[model samples]
Each structure stands twice: as structure tokens, then as C-alpha cells.
Target chain A: MNIVIIDYGAGNTKSVQFACHRLGFSPVLSNDKDVIRLADKVIFPGVGQASNAMQMLKKSGLDSVIPTLTQPVLGICLGMQLLCNTTEEGHTQGLGVFDVAVKRFSNTLKVPQMGWNTIFSLESNLFLGLKNDAYMYLVHSYYAEICEHTISQTNYGLNYSSALKRDNFYGVQFHPEKSSTEGAQILNNFLTL
Target chain B: MLTKRIIPCLDIKDGRTVKGVNFINLIDAGDPVVLAKEYAEKGADELVFLDISATLEGRKTTLEMVLKVAEQVNIPFTVGGGISSIKDVDSLLKSGADKVSINSSAIKRPELINELSAKFGSQCVVVAIDAKQIDGQWMVHLAGGSIPTELNLFNWAKEVEMRGAGEILFTSMDHDGTKDGFANEALSRLSTELHIPIIASGGAGTIQHFVDTFQIGKSDAALAASVFHFGEIKIHELKENLRKNNINVRL
Candidate 1:
């Protein structure tokens, strides 16, 4: 299947693209709207700040095209944040796919909940073989608050959205590509979607 | 909740891993990729590839090597050494690196942080501070700990955060490779001061050391080496221990 990775100029798409290649799925990396519309699956992965990422999406005119996707779309890290209503990183707007705002982790705890954190799985096709509390790799400071569309939850100092799914759009705050064998299994699950 | 991390750092020289005690000794560890994968399975929360040969050997500047190791394992990785500009940062991000850590280059050009953060975002930029406990003060060192900067650890850390770095990767040169246990007091102070996650590196000998670091140091994550490379603590076992300690690990 053709997995399309959105090149919004803000994410670590190479690793995700390479992971898809290793998983026997060929990914076409492009910011082109026509190419994205032709793909069977879409993956939006990012590592940079939130505001600039949104600006890049707007500049490329991909922001308007993103929310219109009918195929299964996965947003990783910053990609997930961009799919939210707003982000605290730069007070920038999001794609508004999910009506949630990304807030910064309180300084009372660590900023970026780095390293491996557990995702409490709920009823969702994104986590098929995964157990109830499966560990996933997370590397971010800003988090999306609990919303109606949340499919999984994780805690740093308090509860936050770990995964969000609505319609054909799915968003994960952690990098599935960096989450070990569990990550590979996640990619496999994402592929079946 | 997340378990505390234990990372192993590999300083690559001419494509081979190099080790040093107190940022000295500079002994050979093994091939960077093999040693990295070993540390990942053993107990490393993350792996750091610092290319010590780029300026000297005229090599690939650690990007391709990072990509090679990244392709092998599904773990978050950081690449340092000879990273000088926005172009370098972009290239490394495109090379599949989760984070790009800056040391002397950042010290020389603080604006680099702002620029990279503007484009790639702060999470992609990890400011690495190599410091030594000198005269009862944590003094920041530059150029692979070969030169000491005028900035103090606390001050520089605050500045780096203000300048838009997502996390601080602090390595105590004095305690590095000594396996004497981390400088918990110093780490604790920095963690209290910085709003970002502080990754403590250097001076880790056993599992008890990891425990003490979390209890005393209160660091968000811990990075180590020899203990992991020598088949000491497995990453899953370490997470289990952290979980058993009621540390709120992801079980």
C-alpha cells in the first residue's frame, strides 16, 4: 500500500518513512496535495515546535488539504499537536480535527515527559495486539488535554491524552517509530487500518 | 507515568566507539552501531552518538552513522559532534535523528538555538552542557571538555531554556566513566532550576546508582554507559525495578 508522509518541514519523516519501508510498505514523501490524496494511508510525524510547523503547513497550503483527508491519517508528536485546536508552544492554531488544545506540562513535574511512558489502551483498532498498559516512547513537553476523542491516556504529573482517534484520523503523542518492538507492532496495526 | 531513563553514550571516532573516564582515557569501546544496539537491549533509555572524529578525520559528521543505528532499533536517539549550523540541524533531522544535541557550537552561537527552534521547534534541539565540579562550582566546559567556559551550569541552563531548547542533556565530565554514582546534588539543583527535562549523564556504576539518582538527584531521566554495555542492567528489568519502587513506570 502507498503510505503518504506529509512533509510539512517540521517532523522526522525520514525515520518514519524508513520504518514504513522496513515494514514492507512503500511511503511517498511529499508536501504535494495530489500525491497525498492518492495514498492509501497517511502519516504525519514531527519533532519541531508547534507554531512554526503550522506556519509551514499554511505556507505549503497543506493545512487546508489536511483536514479534508478521507483516508486513514496518523499524526505523530507535533503532527498530533497540529491536528488539535491550538497549542501552547507558540499560541499557533491547529487543524482543528479534534477539539482539543495542547498545553505545556507544569513545571512542578518535568517539562518534556521524555523516555518511555505507558499508554492505557482503550477500545480502538490502533492497538490490536497491545495489552492494556503498553509502554510507548514519548519525547515532548507540550501535551493535549483530555478530549472526547481520546482513545488512550498517559500521565506525567496528571492525566493527558495519549492517543486520539475520530473517523479515519488518528493522532499519537509519542513516536511509534521510536517505541521498540511495541512500536513496530503499532506500525503494523496502523497499516491494517 | 514513565519510568526514569538510563542512557548510554558512545563517542564515535573513525566509525568506532570510544570511551573515556573523566573525558580522558579515550579507550576503544567497540563498533558504534553494535555497541549502541547492545546498550539498547541491555538497559539504555536512549543512545547518544557523539562523533569525536568529524573535525579531525573529515568524516560524515555522524549523520549517516546515526541513520544506520536508527534503522536497526526503534529507540529514541540523539546525535552530537560537529553540528554547526541550521543546515546541519536540518540535515540531521532528515537523517532520522530524534534530537540533535549541541555543545561548543551552541556556546559560540547562542542564536543557533533560536534559529533551529524557529524552524524545527525546541524539542528537536537538545543543548548539551559538559561541566566539571571545580572549586565547589559547576563550571560549564566547551569543546569536548577541553576548554572551560565562563558560564556556570545553572546560568547557562536557564539561558538555554530561554533561548528555546526543549531539553538539557547535562554531562558531568568529572564523574563520567568513574561509575562512582551521579553528582546527585548538582543534578537536583539543575532539575529544580530548569523547566525542561534534565537528562543526567556520567558516574553510574550499578542499579543502586540509578535508584539513588532518582531518589536524590530527582532527574527526569538518567544516561549511562559501561554498566549497560557490559551486560549489567537490562532496560526492561530496570523499568521493572523502577516500577517495583512505585516510581510510576509504564508497566
Candidate 2:
């Protein structure tokens, strides 16, 4: 399978590639639209500022290419946030793949809500075979509010959309690559889809 | 709310897991990959690999071990010990480590933290501070707690946070390997003072110690080595105890 990892100059693609290799798949890290479009699966993984990431994507013209993907595409962390209509991280606009906006966690609790948290309300095949409320790792200051496309929800000060799905596009706010066994299982599930 | 974390630290030397008493009298623990996999399966929230090797050759072996462990384990892994520059951090992270921790080097050049956090978000930079109490003040130590610096623990912690470190891994040289308890007083102070997460390290002997560190120390995570390596404390039972204690730990 040609699993392409969207590499838009973010410094967080190594682990994602390793995750793919561990799951018995060789992933190609590329910014080329043709390669990404032709792949069996594309993973948009990132852990950086949205404004700069969007700028890079725009400069490479990947901003237009990403939304056109018909194959199963998974967006992780900042990549997930970039799939929304807008984000508060850098006052930047997103691809609008899902009808939602990313907002910063309220100051009432610790920001960046990092560490292992449980995911409930599992509704998609992405969580196939996994127990409900399985622990997955997360680290971010902004979160996507629950929306019509949300397939799973997690609570950290407030319940937010931990996972979202719109047709062939899927997104997870957590870092499944860094998350343990169940996380690896989720990646396998995505691959099977 | 995010659940409290239970991190098992593995001190590696010559590519083998090792444990020491108060930073002395080292003994072989086990294979890091095996132990790490067991810890993750038993519900360890994360794993920290600290290379305590003294020679340059040994550090290279540690990197290879990191590659092996990363290929097998699926948990978030942090690699520490002798990380001096961005190149070192790059190699380790590229080798599949989720985070790179720096200690004495970060102290010598505080800007290293800024540079690292700039290149690879603060989430990837973990500044580890090995501290010891001297003259009624908790002072930062260097070279694995052998050399004392003028920097105070609390002051250095705040400085690291300001410098863009994502988290601070505070190890009490006085409390490490003592098996009595953690430095909750200092851990609590560090927690209340810093905005970022504080990982309380050293002196975790019992399940009650874990409870106290989370409750009294107000630590975001608690890390221990010997008790876990020696099998004196099981990860599942410890987490069960924490859950029973009303602490929100992932089971």
C-alpha cells in the first residue's frame, strides 16, 4: 500500500512514519500532490503552528490538493485542527473539510491538556474492536468543538470532539502514533478502511 | 479532565537497564525493550529512557537501543541524558523518540532550550533538573548530581518554563533512590509556581507514595525506577490503588 504522509515542513513526521513501519506498512513522506492523491491512504500529521503550516501548505499548493482526496485520509493533532473551517491557534482559516471551528481550551483549567485521556461515544470503524473509553494520548491547547461530524468525544474541562469524520476524511485530535497499543489498533483500523 | 500519569523511568548503561541507590551502587535491571513493553501493557502512561553511561561510545549504543525500543513499543517515549544540542535532539527524535530531555547541557546553555523549543515545539523539549538541598536551599546539580550549580531549583524551573520548555522533570538528588517518598513539598511548590506540567521524580517507594505525590505534591506525573524495575511495585495494582484513592488515573 502506498501510504503517504503529508510532510509540510512540520518537525513531527518521524514518529508517524515509524508507526506506519511498525504496523507493517512503508509510508512515504511527501509534499507532492500526485503522490499523496494516488496513495492508498494519506496521513496528515503535524505538531506545529497552524498559521505557518497553512502558509506552507498554500505555498506548495497542497491546500487545494488536500481537500480533494477521495481515499481515506487521517488528520492528526494540528493536521486535525487544520481540517476545521477555522482555528483560534493563529487566527487562520482551515480546509473546512468538517463544519467545525477549533477553539482554545478555556483558561479555567490547564491549557495544552496533555497526556493520556479516554475516548467515549465511539461511533466509527476507526475504533473497531477497541473497548469504549479506551485511553489515547493527547497534547494540545486548542480543541475542536463537538459538531455534526464528531464520531467520538473526550472531556478535559469540557467535552470536545476528539474524533471527526466526513465521508472519506477522518481526523483525531490525539496523537495515535504516540498513543500505545489501542492507538496502534486505531491506525490499523484506518488502514483497513 | 486529563488523567494523572504514571511514568516508569529506565536508566540505561551499556544498552542495559540499570538502577542505582542515591545515584550510586548501580545494578543491572533488565532489557529496556522488554521492561518498556511490559510497563506499557500493564498501563504505564509513559516511559523515560535516561542514558547514564559515562563514555561517548556508550551513548551511541543507547541511541541504537532507542531505535529498537521505538520499533517495538507504541507508548510515548522520552529520551534523556547527555543531550547537548539540536543535532543530538534531532537524531534521537528521528530515531523515533517522541520527546528529547536535556539536563546539564541545558543548564550550561539556557538558550538550548529556546532553540529546541523553537525548532520542535515546546512539547518536544523536556528540561530535566537534578536538584539537591544545600545550605537550606534546593540547588540544581550537574553531571548527574555530582557538580553543584548556583542555580536554585525553583528559579531554574521557572526559567526553563520561560525559555519555552514544555515540561520540567524535577529529580531530587536527596530523595532519589531513598525509597521513603517524593519531595512533595518542593514538587508542590514547583507545581504551584510553574504554568507547565511538573513531573515529580525520585523517592517513590510505595503506592501510597504515588498517591501523596499526586495529591500533596500536585504533580502532573510521577516517575520511579527501582521499585518498578525490581518488581516490588506492579503498574496495574499501583494504578488501581490510585484509582481507588479518587485519583483520575487511566486504567
Candidate 3:
């Protein structure tokens, strides 16, 4: 399978590539539009500020090519946030693939919400074999609001969409690459689909 | 609620784990890759690798170990012991380390914390503070807890947070390796004084110690070495005990 990891020049794509290789797929990391388009599956994974990531994505033209991906595409962390309509982080605009808006986690709770937390209300194929209330690793200060596309939800002082799906495009607020066992299973499920 | 993390730390020397464990099921006591995979499978929330080797060759081995562990274990892990610069942090991160912990080097150059945090974001920087009670004051120690610094423990913790450190791994020199328990008093003080998450390291012998660190110390995570390495305390069982104590843990 041709698995291409989008390199938007922000987050570390090494771990994501390593995760895929562990799953028995030889994944390629690239920013080339042709490489991304011709791939069987694409992974949009990133870290750092949303504005900077969006800027990098636009500069490379992956910003436009990403939303147009017809094959299965998974967006993780910053990549997932970029799929939303807009984000309060740096007041950046997103790809608008999903109709949700990203907002900073309320100060009533911790900002980053780092560490392991459970995800429930699973409805996507990405969670095919996973049980309800499965724990996943999360590390971010901003979260995508619960919307029609939300396939999974998590509670962290407030309920938010932990995972979202709109057609072939899938997004997760948490870092499945960093999450142990269950996280690998999620990636496996995504690859199978 | 975010659950308190139970981390198993491995002391490495020349890419091999320094602690010789005799767990019957373990593949090899000194192989870091084998031990790290075992810890991850056993439900450890995270893993830490402390490279005790001070040689140039040993640093390269630590990087190789980081690559091996990051590829095999699908969990967040931090690397520490010899990291001193942004280049070191960059190399380790590029090798797949989720975070980099700075100890003596951070003490020598306090601004190293700021530079690393600014460049890589605070979440990627973990400042490890080794402190001991000297003359009734908790004074920071350096050079693997042999030399003393003028920085007070509490004040240093606040500075670590202010300087953009994502977390503080506080290891009490007095309690470290003693196996009595974690220095809950110091840990509690650090937690209260600092807003960022505090990982209580140093002394952890039993499951109760983990519970005390979480409940009493208010630590966001508990890190242990000998206890976990020797199989003296099983992480799954310890987590079960914590769960029974009404403490949230990933089971």
C-alpha cells in the first residue's frame, strides 16, 4: 500500500512513519502533490502553532491538495485541527473539511490536557475493534468543538469531539502515534479501511 | 479526568540498561529495547531513559536506543542524563523521542530551558531538578547529585515553569535510591508552588508509595527505577491498587 505522510514542516513525522512501518506498511514522507495524490492513504500529522503549520501547508500547496484527497486520509493533532473551519489558536483559518471550529481549552481546566484520557461515543471505522471508553494519549491546548462530524467524544472539564469523521476524511485530537497498543490498533484499523 | 501517570525509568550505559534485573520472563536484563517493550506492554503510562554513560560513544548509543524504543513501543517516552543543548534536543527529537529532559546542563545555563522551549515548544522540554535538604533548605544539586547550586528547590521549580518548561521531574537526592518512599513533602510543596505538572521521582518502593505520591504528593506522575526494573512492583498491579484507592489510572 502507498501510505504517504504529509510533511508540512511543523510536527515530527518520524514517529508517524515509524508507527506505519511497525504496522507492516512502508510509508513515505513527502510534500510533493503527486506523491500525496497518488498514494493509497495519506496521513496529515503535525505539531506546533496552527498558524505556522497552516502557513507551511499553504506555502507547499498541500493545504489545497489535502481537502481534495479522495482516498482515506487521517489527520492527527495539529493536522486534525487544520481540518476544522477555524481555530482560536493564532486566529488561523483551516481547510474547512469538517464543519467544526477549534477553540482553546477553557482555563477552568488545564490548558494542554496532556497525558492519557478516555474516548467514548465511538462511531467511526477507525475505532472498529476498540471498546468504548478506551484510553488514548492527548497533548494539546486547543480542541475541536463537538459538531455533526464528531464521531467520538472525550471529557476534560467539558465534552469535546475527540475524534471526527466527515466522509473519507478522519481526524483525531489525540496523538495515536504516541498512544500505546490501542493507538496502534486505531492506525491498523485506519489502514485496513 | 486526566489520570496520574506511572512511569518506569531505565538507567542506560552504552545503550544497555545498567540495572541488572532477574525477572524470569524478561528477555535480557540489560537490553533497553527488551525492557522498554516489556514496560510498555505491562501498562506503563510512559517510559524514561537516563543515559548514565558520559562518553561521546555512549551518547550515540543512547540515540540509537531512543530510535529502537520509539520504533517498537507506541508510547510517549523521554530521554535524559546527557542532553545539554538545542542540538542535542533536536537530534533526540528527530530520533523519535517524545520529550527531552534537561538536568545538570539546565542548572548550568538556566536559559537553556527557555531556548529549548521557545524552539521546540514547552511540551517537549522536561526540566529534571535534583534537590537535597541542606541546612534546612532544599538546595538544587548538580553533576548527578554531587555538587550543590544556590538555587532553592521551590524557587527553581517556579523558575522552571516561568521559563516555559512543560513539566518538572523532581528527584529528591535524599530519598532517591533509599526505597523508603518518595519525598512527598517536597513533592507536595513543588506541586503547590508550581502550576505545571510535577513528576515525583527518587524513592518509590511499593504500590503504596505510588499512591502516596499521587494522593499526598499531588504529583501528576510517579517515576521509579529499581522497583520497576527488578520487578519488585508490577505496574499493572500497582495501577490496580491505585484504582482501588479511588485514584484514576489507565487500567
Candidate number achieving the greatest DockQ relative to the actual structure: 1
For model 2, the superposed segments whose C-alpha errors exceed 4 Å read B20-30
| TM-score: model 1 vs. ground truth | 0.92
Each candidate: RMSD: 3.4, 3.0, 1.5
In candidate 1, list every pair of residues with a backbone clash: A11-A46, A48-B120, A49-B121, B7-B223, B7-B224, B42-B235, B43-B235
Model 1 Cα lDDT, one tens digit per residue, B1-251: 67776676777777667664122212434656666666556546677877778564434635567778867766878888888898887777777888899988889999998898777777778999999978988999988798988999999999999998988888899998798998899989988887888888989887777787888898888887666655566667776777677665544
**Model 1, CA-based lDDT:** 0.81
lDDT per residue, candidate 2, B1-251, as tens digits? 58999998888997888764232222323678877777778889999999989998998899899988888888898999889989999889878788889999999999999999877788888899999999899999999899999999999999999998989899999999799999999999999988888899999999999999999999999999888776788889999999999999988
Residue B101, model 2, lDDT: 92
Runs of candidate 1 exceeding 4 Å displacement: B20-29, B54-58, B232-240, B248-251
lDDT of each: 0.81, 0.89, 0.89
Stretches of candidate 3 off by over 4 Å are: none
Q: Ten residues in a row with the worst lDDT in model 3 chain B?
A: B19-28
TM-score for chain B of each model, two decimals: 0.88, 0.94, 0.98
Q: On a 0 to 100 scale, what is the lDDT of residue A8 in model 1?
A: 76
lDDT of 2 by residue, A75-138 (tens): 9999999999999977999999999999988866655677999999999999999998998999
Q: Could you tell me which 10 consecutive residues in candidate 2 chain B have the lowest summed lDDT?
A: B20-29
Residue B188 alpha-carbon offset, candidate 2, angstroms: 1.1
